[model samples]
Target: MLKLLIAVIFFAILLSLAAGAGFLIRDQSPSTRLLTSLKTRILLTALLMVLLVYGFSQGALGT
Candidate 1:
């Protein structure tokens, strides 16, 4: 379950990245969508890092 959550968050970050790229290509002028996407990706990445650390610390995830 925890692993699934991590994967979902990771995918969300990827999706945000793609969206940002699309926004960059579609919008010639300054846009808020790209900035929002970047912010979302950053937050999701931080969340993923925190979850990974907690999972490892609790022995819920490991090799």
Candidate 2:
């Protein structure tokens, strides 16, 4: 379950990255879509890091 959550968050980050790229290529004027995607990615990444640290501390990850 925890691993599944980690994978989901990781994939969400990837999706956000793709959205940012699409926004960069499709948007001509200054827009917030890219920025929003960036913020989402950053938050997801932070969540992932926190989950990883928690997993390691709980002996749920690593050897």
Candidate 3:
């Protein structure tokens, strides 16, 4: 369980970093671009949360 949490956290951080890079390169003067960044964050966060929950529940975290 502990390891599962650790892996989940690490994965989340990596995903967040990738999204951050994409966000940084996006347009700087458009509200649509801003929304795109927000959308990416939300999607990644949700994906990580779901993956963590599923992994912990199924005891497949590190397998």
RMSD in Å for all candidates:
0.8, 0.5, 5.6
Per-residue C-alpha lDDT of model 3 across residues 31-60, encoded as one tens digit per residue: 465466567667767766787787779887
Model 2 lDDT tens row, 1-63: 889999999999999999999999999998899999999999999999999999999999889
lDDT of 3: 0.68
| RMSD value for candidate 1 | 0.8
Candidate 1 vs. true structure, TM-score: 0.95
TM-score against truth, every candidate: 0.95, 0.97, 0.51
Reference-based lDDT, each prediction: 0.95, 0.96, 0.68
For candidate 3, what is the TM-score? 0.51
Please name the candidate that would achieve the greatest lDDT relative to the true structure.
Answer: 2
Candidate 1, residue 14: how far the Cα is off, in Å: 0.8
**Model 3 weakest lDDT span, ten residues long:** 29-38
Off by over 4 Å in 1: none
Better of 1 and 3 by lDDT: 1
Residue range 1-63, candidate 1, lDDT tens digits: 999999999999989999999999999887799999999999999999999999999999997
lDDT of 3 at 9: 61
Off by over 4 Å in 3: 1-28
